[model samples]
Target chain A: MHISYNQKEVLKGINLSVEKGEVVSFIGPSGTGKTTLLKCINYLEKPQQGEIQIGDLHLNYQSLSKQDILKLRRKTAMVFQMFNIFKHKTVIQNVMDAQIAVQKKSKNEAYAMSLKQLENVGLKDKINEYPSRLSGGQLQRVGIARGLALEPELILFDEPTSALDPELVEEVLKVIEDVAKSGMTTLLVTHEMDFAKRISDKVVFMENGHIVEVGTPEQIFEKSVNVRTRQFLKKIYAEQDQQKLNIKGG
Target chain B: MTLETGMQELLMEFLKTLPINIIIIILSAALGLLFAVLLTFVRLKRIPVISQLADLYVSFARSVPGLILLFIAYFGIPKVLPLIGLGTYDISPMHAAIISMGFYHSGYISEVFRPAYLAVEKSQHEAADSLGYTPMQKFFRIILPQMVPVALPGYGNALVYLIHDTSLIFAIGIVDIMGTAELSIARSYGTNQILIYFIIALMFSAMCFTTDGLVRKLEKRVAIR
Candidate 1:
C-alpha cells in the first residue's frame, strides 16, 4: 500500500500483516509516518493506493463505498495519543456511545458492558465523572475502556503514553500490558522503547515512509542488521542513559 | 388629563403592548436559531451551490439595515410571490416582522455557531470515526453538545439584539410596545412623550439584564469542567 499528502509520499509500498492474538508495535522517529500508517489501517486517513484486510473484511481505498469503509472500521478500535474522550460525556457514556450507536445494543446492555470495561481498566469509581475531572492517566484509561467496549477484532494504540507526564505513563502502559496479555490482536505506534520491548511480540522499524526492519524485539533492539535501525536504537538508548544520569546527579 | 392620570394611562398602554413584544421576540429568536443551524451546517459541509447561497444570504442579511429588510418583507415579498405563479398574498405586519427579524438575526447566529463548532478539536472527530460511529451519530452525540457551551455567549447576544429589533415592527405599523408608546404620545399631543420613551428604554434594559443572567447560569451548568 502507498499513501501521500499533498503529492508527497507518506507510506510507500508497505506490506505487513498481524496474526490473530499477536501484539505488534511500530517504533520510529518523529515525522516517520507511524501514526499515518495506523490511521490508514482503519481508513481514517484514506491511502491513495492500498488494500487493507482485517480478518474477513477487505477494503481497497480506491473503490470502497461508505458502507464498506464503516464495515472495515467496525473491526478495529483506536486509542488516540491525546485521549480524545467526548468532552460533554461522562466517562461511562464515552465507553457506551459506540455500543449503542453503531452496534445497536439496548441501553441496558450497553450500560452493563461499559461498566465492566471501565472496571477492567480500574475506573469503576470515575464512571459518572466527565473527562475534564480526570487526570491524564485516568483519561487514557477511559480511552482504553472505550476501545475495549466494542470487542473489536483488533485494537490500535497511537502513541498513547506520549501525552502523559512521566509519572503517569506507567498506569496507562500497565493497562496496555494487560490488554496484550489477554491474547487480543493489537497494533501500536509508540515511542516507549522499553515498554514496546516488553509487550510486543513483533517490532517494526520504519523511516521515511518505509519499513526498514521487522523482527522479534531482541532481534530489532540488539541484533539489527540495517545501519539506520541500529543508529536509531543507539540514539534512543543514549538519551535514556542521559536522563537517568541527570536524575542521579540531581 | 392631570399628570397622575396621564402617567397611569401610559403605564396601562405599555402593559397592553408588552405581550405582543414578548411573543414576537420569542418566535423570531426560535426561528432564527433553526435557520442558523441550517446555515452553519451547509457552510461546514461545503456543499457547492448551497454553501455559496448560504454565504450570500448571510452577507446580504448582515449588510442590509434591519428596517429595510422589514420593508422588503412587508412590501416586496407580495410582489415576488405573484411572479413565482403563487397568486398575490398579503403579508401581515406581524408575519413580516417575524420573518425579517428571524432571517436577519440568523445571519449573526450562524456566525456565532460556525466558529464554536469548528473550535472542537479534530481529534474528537477522528476518535468517533475510528469507533465506527456514523456521521449523524458523531454529530449529535459528540459534536453538538460540545458546541452549546461555546456558542451560548453569542446566542445570548443575538437574543438581546432581537429584543431591540422587535421595536422596528412599528415601521410596518404593528402595535408592539414602541408602536403603542407612539400612539399614546400622539393621543397626548406629545405632552407625555419623554415619559413614554423613558419607560420603553427601562423595559428593554430589564429584559436584556434578565437574559444575561439566565445565560450566565446556563453557561455555568454546561461548562466542560
Candidate 2:
C-alpha cells in the first residue's frame, strides 16, 4: 500500500502485498523512512495518502481516531528499536500489566500467558527480575515476549537488532528467525542482510522513501534489475564479504 | 499535690481549645494538599508564568524558615484581607500558622516529583498508546503507578515537616502538647530550665524516631525497577 507523511510523499504511490505466512524484510539506509513506513502500517502514525489493511481490519486516515486505532493496535504489534519494557516492573510483570489491565485477563490467566511468552523467548528464569537486571540481548527477548503475549496477527519489527551489541545481535536475530519460520506474517526493518536472505520470503529494497527493488530472496539478492539496488547492496555487503574471502584464501 | 494541680490545669486548658486546634490543622492540611496538587499540575502542563510563581513561593518559604512564614501570614493577612473584606474575618495566629506550614513545604514536594516524571522512558508511553490505552488508562495504570515509588520519598519528608511544624501552631494560641507543656511549666515550676528542656526533647524524640523508621521501611519496599 502507498503511504505518505505531511503531504510530501514518503511511500510514493508504492504497491505490495504479503500472503499469509510470508516474511518480508525492508532494508535501507537510515532516514529513508523505514521506521515511518512501519509506524504507518501499524496505524501508530496515520498515513495521509493510503490504505492500511491488517488481517480483516481496514484503516485509512479516518480510522486513525483514538478508539479505532487502539482497536487496530490490539490486532497488530510493533517491537520498537529500543526495548520499551516498563522500567518500574519485573520482566514478567511488564508482560502481564497490559494483559490484566486492558485485556482484563485474570491474574492467573495473565501469569500463565506471561510465563508461556517468557519461556518462548528463553527468559523464563528472569521472570521476577527487573529490566535493569537484564543484558541488551535479554531485554530485547523480553520485549519480543511482550509483543508475543498479545498473540497479534501480524508483528512489525523496526530494526530489532540494530540497538544490540555485536555479540548480542545473534540471539535477538535467532528469536526473530524462529518467529519468521513459525509462519506468522512478519515485516522487519533490519540491517542484518544475511538474516534477511536466510529467512525472508520476500525482500523489499527501499531507497529515498520508495521501493527500488521488491522480489523473493533469490530474485532480489542474486538477480537484480535495478542498478541502484546493486550499488546499495555492494556498499552494504562489501566489507563482510571481503573478510570472508580473505579467511578462505588463508 | 502541687504538680498534680499543674497537670490538671494543662489538660483543662488543652481540652477547652482542642476543637479549634484540630480543625485548623485538618482544614489547613487539606488546603495545602490542594495547592500542592495544583502547583504540580501547573508545572507538568508547562505553564511558564505559574511554574515561576510556584518556584518563587517555594524558595521564599524554605529560605525564611517556617516560624517566620507563620509570623508573616498571621500578621500580614489581616492587613491585606481588609481590602478584600476578608478584613471582617478574624484571622487567628493558628490559622495563619497552619497555612504557612502546609504551603511552604509543598514546594519541596513538587520539586522531588519533577525529575521522576522525566525519568519515565518515553517508549513506555508509546507502547501504552500503541496498545490503545485511553488517556485515563495511560495515566492511572501506566504513569501514576510508576510515579508512586518516586513520590513516596518526597511525601515522607513532607509528613515529617507537617508534624514538626505543628509546634508553630502553639504560637497562634492552639493549646497543643507544646502549648500545654509551656503553660503547665510556667505555673508549676516557675523557672526550672533543665526540666523543661528534658521534657520537651524526650516527647519530640518518640514521634521523630517512629516517623523516621516508617520512612526508611517504605523506601526499601518501593525500590524502583
Candidate 3:
C-alpha cells in the first residue's frame, strides 16, 4: 500500500497481512503512519495505491467504488483513539447505531445485542448515560463494545489507550486483552510495549512509514537483529524505568 | 384621547393585521430554512460553478436591505415568471414579500448552519464512516442531530431579525401590521401617531421575545447530554 497526502508520502509501499484469529500489534513512535495504516484497512484515509484482501473480499484502491468502500468497512471495525462515540446518543444507542445502520438489525434485536456487548464491557449499569457523563476509560470501553458487537472479521484499534489518562489505560487494555484471548483477529496500533508484549501473537515495529521488523513478541522485545528496533525498545524501557522510579519516590 | 385609551384602540387595529404578518413570517421562515439547507450543502460540497453562485447569492442576500429585496421581488418575479412559462399567474405583494424575506433569511441562516456543522468533530464523521453508514444516514442521523443544538441560538436571532424585516413589506403595499399601522395613521391624518407607533413597537417586541424564548427552551431540550 502507498498513501500520499497532498503529494507527500505517508505510507510508502507497505505490505502486510493478518491471518484469521491472529492478534497482530503494530508498535511505533508517533507520526510513523501507524494510525494511517489502520485507517487504510477500512478506507477511512484513502491510500493512493494499494490492494487489500480480508478473507475472500479483495479490493484495489485505485479503482475502488462507493459500494466497495462500504463492503470494506463492513468487514472490519475500528476503535478510535478519541473514542468518537456519538455524543448525541445514549451509551446503548451508541453501540446500537452501527448494528441498525449497517447490520440492518431491528431496534429490538439491536437493543439486545448492544446490551450483551455493554455487559461484557461492564457498562450495563451505564447504558442510559451519555458519552459526556462517562470517564475516558468507560468511553473507550463503550467504543470497544461497539466494535465487538459487530462481530467483524477483523477489528482495528488505533492506539486505543493513547488518549486515556495513565491510570485509566489499564481498564481498556484489560478489555482488549480479553478480545485477544477470545481468538478474534485484531490489528492494533499502540505504544504500550508491555500490553502489546503480553497480548500480541506477532509484534511489528514500524518507523517513518516502514516496517523495521516483524517477529514474535519475544523476538522483537528480547533478541532483535534490527538496530532501530533495539534502540526504540531501549528508549521505551528507559521511560518505563523512569516512571517506576518516580512512582516509588512519590 | 389619553395615552392608555389611544394605545388600547390602536392595539386592536394592529392585531387585525397580525395574522397576515404571522403568515409571512411562518411561510418565509420555512422557505428560508429549505434554501439554507440547500445552500449549506452546496457550500460544504463545493460544487464548482453552483457553489460560487450560491456564495454570491448569500453575500447579496446578507448585504442588501430587505426593503430593496421586497422591491426587486415585487417587480422582478412578474417578469421572470413569464419567461419561465408561468405567464398567466400574477404575483401579489404578499407573495413577493414572502419570497424576498425568504431569500433574505436564507443567507443569515446558512451562515448559522455552515459553522454549526463544522463545529462537530470530524472524528464523528469518521466514526460513522467506519461503521459503514451510507452518506444520507450519516448526515441525517449522526450529523444533523448534533448540528441542531449548536445552530439554535443563531437561528433564533435570525428569526428575530426576520420579524423586524417584515416591517419593510409595508413599503410594497402588503397590509401586514406595519402596513395597517401606516394606513390607520394616514386615515386619522397623523393624530396620535406616537401612540400608534408605540403600540407597533410593543407588538414586535413581544413577538421577538416569544420566538427567542421558544428557541432557548428547544435548545435545552435537544442539547446533547
Candidate 4:
C-alpha cells in the first residue's frame, strides 16, 4: 500500500500479507504510519494507491467506491487507543450498537451476543455502566467487546493500550492476548515490545514510512540482521529497563 | 384604589394576554430550533453558497437588535411579498413576531448546535465507521444522543432569550403581556403604573425560571449517558 497525505508519502509502497488467524504486530516510533496502515486496511484512511484484499473483498484504492469501502470495513473492526466506545451508551449498548446497526440483529439477538462478548472481556459485572464510570482497562475491554460482538473476520488494534495508565495496561493486554490466542486474525500497532514479542505470530518493524524488517519475535528482538531494527530494539529495551528501574526506585 | 385591588386588577389583565405570549414563545422556539438545525447542518457540511448565506443570516441575526428584526418582519415582509409578485399578503403582528423571534434566535441556537455537534469527538465517527454503521445510523444512534446533552445548556439559554425577546413584540402593537400592561396603564392615566410593570416583570421571570428548570431536568435525563 502507498499512502500520502498532502503530497507527502506516509506509507511508501508497503507490501505485506497475513495468513488467516495469524496475529501480526506492527511496531515503530511515532509518525511511521503504523496506525495509518491499520486505518487504511479498514478504509478509515484512504490510501493514494494500493490494493487491499481481506477475505473475498478486494479493493484498489484508486477505483474504490463508497460502497466498496463500507463493504471492506464491514469485514473488520478496529480497537482504538482511546477506546472510542460510545460514551452516551452503556457498556452493553456499546457492544450491541454495531451488532444492531451493521449486522441488523434484533434487540434480543444483539443483547445475547453482546452479553456473551462482554463476558468474554470480563465486563459482565459492568454491563450497565457507562464508559465514563469504568476505569481505562474496563473501557478498553468494552472497546474489545464492541469489536468482538461484530464477529469480524479480522480485528485491528491501533495501539489499544497506548492511552492507559501503566497499572491498567496489563488488563487490556491480557484481553488482547486472549483474543489473539483464540485464533482471530489480528493486526496490532503497539509500543508494548514484550507483549508484541510474546503474542504476535509475526512482528513487523517499521520506520520512516517503510518496513525496516519483518521477522518472528526471536529473530527481530534477539538477532535482527537490519541495523535499523536492532537499533530501535536496543533503544526501546533500554527505555523499558529505565522505566522498570524507576518503578523499583519509586 | 388599594394596592391589593390594583394588583388583582393588573394581574387579571396580564393573565388574559398571557396565552398569546406563551403561544408566541412556543411557536417561535419551534421555528427557531428547526432553522437552527438547518443552519448548523449547512455550516457543518459547508454547503457552498447556501452555507455562506446561512453564515450571513447568522451574522445578521446575531448582530442586529431583536426589535429591528421585529420591525423588518412586520413592515418589510408584507411589502417585499407584493414586490416579488406573491400578491398582497397581510402579515399580522403575531405572525411577524413569531417570524422575527424565530429567525433572530436561530442564530444563537446554531452557534450552540454547531459547537455541540463538533464537540462529539472525531474518534466516535471513526469507531462507528469501523463498525460499518451507515451514516444515518451513526448520527441517530451515536451522534445525536451525545450531541443533544452537550447542546442543552446553550439551547436552554436560547429558549430563555427567546422568552425575553418576545417582549419586543409589544413594540409592533401585539396585545401580549407587555402590550396589555401598557394598554392598562394608558387607560388608567398612569394609575398603578409601577405595580403593573412590576407584575409583568414577575411573569417574564417566572416563565424564564420554568424554562430553565425544564431544560435542567431534560439535561439530567439525557446526560444519563
For DockQ, the strongest prediction is 3
Query: Which 10 successive residues of model 1 chain B have the least lDDT summed?
Result: B1-10
lDDT of each: 0.90, 0.77, 0.91, 0.90
The C-alpha stretches of model 2 lying farther than 4 A from their native spots are: A1-20, A42-51, A60-63, A208-210, A241-250, B1-35, B47-96, B177-190, B193-202
The CAPRI category of model 2 is: acceptable
- Write the residue-wise lDDT of candidate 4 on B67-157 in tens digits: 9999999999999998989999999999999999999989999999999999999999999999998888889999999899999998999
Selected candidate, larger lDDT, 3 vs 4: 3
Best model per lDDT: 3
Ranking by DockQ: 3, 1, 4, 2
Clashes of each: 0, 0, 0, 0
Q: Is candidate 2 or candidate 3 better by DockQ?
A: 3
Q: Each predicted complex: what DockQ?
A: 0.84, 0.46, 0.86, 0.75
Q: What is the lDDT of residue A206 in candidate 1?
A: 93
| Cα DockQ of the candidate 4 complex | 0.75
Stretches of candidate 3 above 4 Å error?
Answer: A1-8, B1-9, B81-90
C-alpha lDDT (0 to 100) for residue B24 of candidate 2 = 56
Pairs in steric clash, model 4: none
CAPRI-style class, candidate 3: high
Worst 10 residues of 4 chain B by lDDT: B6-15
Model 2 lDDT tens row, A173-207: 98998899988889999888889999999999988
Task: Give the per-residue lDDT digits (tens) of candidate 3, residues A1-250.
Answer: 2222321388776878678899999998889988988898898888888788888887888889999999989888999999999999999999998899889999999999999999999999999999999999999999999998988988899999999999999989999999999989999999999999999999999899887898999999999989999999999999999999999999
